[model samples]
Target: MIALLGCGVVLLSACGSMPVTGDIKAVDASQPGDSQVQVYAVAPRENATPDEVVDGFLESMTSDDPGFRTTRKYLTKEASRTWKPSAFTTVLSKAPNRSQRPVRDSDRSSTELTFTLTGDKVATVDAQNAYQPVAPTAFSRSLHLVRQNGSKEWRIDFVPDGLLLGQSDFKRLYRSVNKYYFATGPAADQSTLVADPVYVRNRTDPITGMDTVTQTVRSLVEGPTNWLRPVVDSRFPTGTVLRKGVTALAPDDRNVLKVPLNKKADGVGQRSCRMMASQVLYTVRDLTSARVEQVELQRSDGSSLCVLGSGQAEEFAPDGSSGAPDSQYFVDDEGHVQRIPGSNKGSGDPEPVAGPLGDGPVRMSTVGVARDEQLAAAVSQDSASLYVASVVSAGELPRPAVTSRAKKPEDRLSAPSWDGRGDLWVADRNPDDRRLLRLAGGTGEPSNVRVPDLGGARIEALRLSADGVRIALLLTEDGHTTLKIGRIERQGDPDTLQDVSVVELRKAAPQLADVTAMSWSGRSRLVVVGKEQGGVQQVRYVQVDGSAPASGVLPGANQVSSVAAADDEQLPLMADTEDDGIVKLSPGDNWQTVLKKGSSLVYPG
Candidate 1:
């Protein structure tokens, strides 16, 4: 074991006689680049008090110690040997407040020190490294300390099972990364990749001694998380893993990443091997500063299995778009569906679409464009019926594909949404006839979608992910609206919908008391408009797993009634505000007025 005296003495001698008078300065602890700050741990000193020992142990949890060697010195021999730091992590809003007291033994011969730790819990990271955020709640834990019969040094006999950290420390140490897997039921010619986001140590991982890039590759081979396992599949075979002693990965001069695999993956076929390589390329594309243009997989004996280029990987993009969208569509003041240029920098003149919905008898209140941009579904001005029409040429509007009989317009129908698979979704909010409906290919007969776990809540609005594997729902119960995400499960052919359902509804933004509008911003994230209890409305981005991203809050908008975003994040974010009409927010810029009067805005799904 490493001696604790070396670190303890150095720290004491450096600050033994320093002056303690200076002007106080304030610093922003939540800056974006704080992750680059390194933390060093100091071991306990000789003859330390009980409070000092407890404080030192808690501070060491935030340090960059390798395997937490110095942290174990503050614990008794038995506790040190049995402690497991990798079990889970509990994150508080700030450093926990500690208070100490004395506890008498049953025989009244000896006394032990008990310290209570209290804070507001913010989130928790499970053993699988999945993050789940919750509403702030009170937290309390206790630690017990005892000294040997003849020793003056105090050591902790009881400690928490896993690590505990504050919000700032947790942000500095961990980073979020997305791993890619193929959607379960897509055909071989139409395989689509889905993202599974998780957290890993920003620098070297203490448990595996692997860097961030290598850690991400290893996680992809391990398969998707439990909640997503029912709707996705991994091409990596069972028992596959990285070669022994491989601890780092980087792109070569030609921007190619070579991955070495164990014997379990040695027998994969050429096609399957390329698919495996695509998964690696997509997973690591955003991790490194230098772009990775290709990926080459190597076998156990140092022979190349197969190679996949970046262009080939685009064949399986989630949205299936050629590139970024060229235009964004919305309903203008005259109830016509008009479109403007999709560039983020400046605004352009808006023009009507090519179909009857753009200039017809039925006035449209909202619209949903197909992923291919060839067709659109529009809800009537009164929200009582939904119509579909071709947008590429002049044509007559089709009859209403869905209709509602609710007396009140607000309780009739919601804005329609199109998924990557060409299916349309909407909800009828009538109290007497509430149902979630889906139309196959936006032209088939509407069918009721079974939501087994919705309890008694009514759907107010809905959005489908670009990959067609997930859905976001705004649910209202007792006059309170909340955001929830559910997995989309289909039980038939890819081209046709036979049996469809949305199951396993989980809260996506538990911190917010009311959700008004939302749009899918990226593969695993959503831009939401909501407010906390007794707080003002705010716009922010949250992951599908419910964790808020670092620097996710956008510039404030007033009374945003609806919002729209493209799968490609480079496009501008559009929203309709009651006070500012229709506004667009681009990257690194403030909100700008796009139109003085508009109700709903949307991009191709």
Candidate 2:
């Protein structure tokens, strides 16, 4: 559950617009039924006091305006011109302490309104439309307010860049929306479209729906929202635009979307064209909840260039196949990797994987496997080295794939992660060498992946999503651990990662103060262990959006050492508990020990 730093009051009107003094009512098609609409918030009154203006401005920032036009009203003309709300958005977990004090050595009328910002820095959205995580810290923003000559009204003359909002308001104002991008896979079959999750305003313009279907397409055409931009490409050209502007997108009567492109798609090949259509189809489906069956890409002349069926879109979606492996793999008492058979009903003795890594004398403290279950990466018992070897019998000793450069033995390396591209990811926890590294598959050299500014936090654990686009990291700072997500940006087929190409980190579970272990439970959900400060260790499931289901902690589990779940949400959950070795939990069922003596557990892919 999200921790509330301070109390918050709702400032916006109801979700729907209602008639004022008569029987007539306004039908708001764009109003969100599940959430409130802040687009209709009241603006600051004319000639308001400096404090009121600042408070109103903060409240107005929660409105659903596209360019923050309503929010700029509180600013002076010159200040508004210089202000760029898109530059950044600072989300606070609670309201800040506000005060206005006279600026010294300046005009007596010059007043500086200071906002003592406190509480969790939940998330930050950058000018590039990418959102990243920020650790909880107390910060301040000073707004200089002065009276305008002509109007004699006090407006903010100078202020910090970006908009600020409390956590409660942030939840009601923004929502997670996914844009589909094609993942590089077998060329013969262009399957596997990954979901690049992004947050968009929840409400849209009532008449045009710009915040709905149109926003999804526009964001997609703008390209991947994060580091995925380097690896993923869109078939849409440089200047692709929806016909009739961004607001002109809607499904047709037969559930077919007639997407009129500004540029002609005649040059795109058949396979690429279909892939383009699939991208649009999947993106639109996410908004319309599969109300759209197909997407027909059309030329400016209205001729159909290509059509993508909904069936085709499903063939390569994130959940395209049977999902991640059902069988759970873990390290046994002797440090050998063992597998528990059956999907959710596995019982009896555990079997070792068909490789030397599972049965050899090499003592592995932690392990990770590739998506295809073809290979496994293991960390030595001392956590000073990493080894990657084939899961199938190779008749060779597991070779050292990665060794930490740290001087201390305990801070050497983290458990390794394998992405869909077959690249392995790990973080060096050494305080002096706090860095993330990606190793090319099959004994390739390791390249340092840049980590975003973590506010002096050191990464303790790193888990890569199966899609290879996003990564989960457990960062420890000041004795507190945080869970964050970052995007992986790769330079175009480079032998080594360029300094400019690095994973941009963001907040995925900003509410959780201590997260020891986590695993991707589904495409967007993570099964995490650890709890709020001073709370008992229990397994809780969390979404990539920083929200958790009401299912609460896993039943019959305690002091979970590690947790593992498949990409398929329906599969049973596996975790290594303090007392129980390896336990499995089917939905709505209590935990049952599957392996009597296991340590760490994972599911291939």
Candidate 3:
């Protein structure tokens, strides 16, 4: 039996004279900590009233009862047989408010009671456990109850198929985990893995009776979410699934996890099997407390298919095996691109990058380093010209790869960004000829990438994800700036350049009234510098899906103009501030000044 916390029954009178007897307890819907305190539902008491039955069911939805069996006790037999909690989840800003009303029969007698649950909807978790945040809107759902034929007890006969939870309860019961998938497309490398983030129960999943690890692996085998499916692939063979009746999975004493798959994966080649094992190793690395040093794939007949160690899995790492970046780059007081060792110990004197962009005639105001750190794309001081050159060897400054004809400096080009595919992206802010352009291999002719849903908004800044499949854009319109994440779709052969466009744009930070800067901080997260309505500027980490994490907000800084973060979390976060020049915030430390006169700081994309 599970222990119940902060539960108490409240009794009241019905018509100012008759007594109402039932057990209706208020749920303590507070957010749980990292330890993940568990909550379980209570069975309904005898002779419960209609309101009591509805309240009991709603509270039970927030608990960890196995199969939600206790919750079904408050429902009619027909409803219990038909309800599907795994269909989806509706997340509200707070616990839903309930109001009761009576349903009349043809004879004008009260035959049933309907309780309406209403709140501010914040997000929705689809059947695949994919989270999608939406602008907050009003939500209302009705549950109808009736008296049983044999007993006077009230039971719910009509209820929604999915669970309704408050944001706080959702955070307490679920966690966001990234499942790995191989990148696909003309420019994508077959060996590189991309992150596909989804939500899963933090502890044991009630609906499936599976532990966290098993649930995550199940989600992985089910493939990527709808939004990301077009750009990624899974090595797991079609119709692959966990062995029948397997609910719990644990790493062995040697920290090796063995996964038993159905026959569909039994005939895969050695290379494909190893790649599949790597995907599992990467996906479960962060989900469990115990270290998973290796993963072994097993056939349906219990024979070994292949094994992959953690070190071997690094070959398919999204950011490559270069480890953390060596240095951070920025423009110095002299308008020349410079770099400093990207270490947390202490700051070092800035040095010029090896080529023309560092010492040439053209003064650069902003810079973007390629993922490999071998090349850099710099925008001229006036923001009209974008030049690309090698950062490892000295050479003459290459001609402008892209140039904007916008008359005003502020209306010219935004900062350039390089994706993991070695391609370059930048937005021209020219009002008469606004276009989002991409350079094939950072050298080919600039091509205008179509943005079908941009409407009339202007792009203030743009950052591409390391996987090259998602692009973050700070769109400004009517004096308001918002952050949006767009999906990058490419067409054509792998070797030759082709058409590229950004589509299916979604808001990444809807709560902020104005966004000044942002950078990709993790696989599916961003460090955003923005301000909410009637609020001061703040630094927070927001998931690509728009939902804020538990530890999202960072320590505050003043007058921040720009911010940068490396894919590796250990590297300190750097920012350019008007009051403090360049500053960095290391893990477990407050912001410290790195330099007193540097700007446009950034780590390799």
Candidate 1 Cα lDDT to native: 0.83
For model 1, residues 295-378, the per-residue Cα lDDT tens digits are 999999879999999998887665554474557888988888987766533288888999898898888999998888888889
Model 3: per-residue Cα lDDT over 351-463, one tens digit each: 89999988999998999998888899999999999999998899999889988999999999999998888888889999999999988888878988999999989999999
Question: What lDDT would candidate 3 get against the real structure?
Answer: 0.86
Q: What is residue 443's positional error in candidate 2, in angstroms?
A: 6.2
Please tell me which model should have the higher lDDT, number 1 or number 3: 3
Q: How accurate is candidate 2 locally (lDDT)?
A: 0.69
Q: Estimate the TM-score of every prediction.
A: 0.92, 0.74, 0.94
Task: Report every candidate's CA lDDT.
Answer: 0.83, 0.69, 0.86
For 412-468, candidate 2 gives per-residue lDDT tens digits of 888788776667888888777777778776357777776656668888887777676
lDDT of 2 at 338: 76
The weakest ten consecutive residues by lDDT in model 3 span: 9-18
RMSD of 1: 3.9
Q: Kindly indicate the candidate among 1 and 3 with the higher TM-score.
A: 3
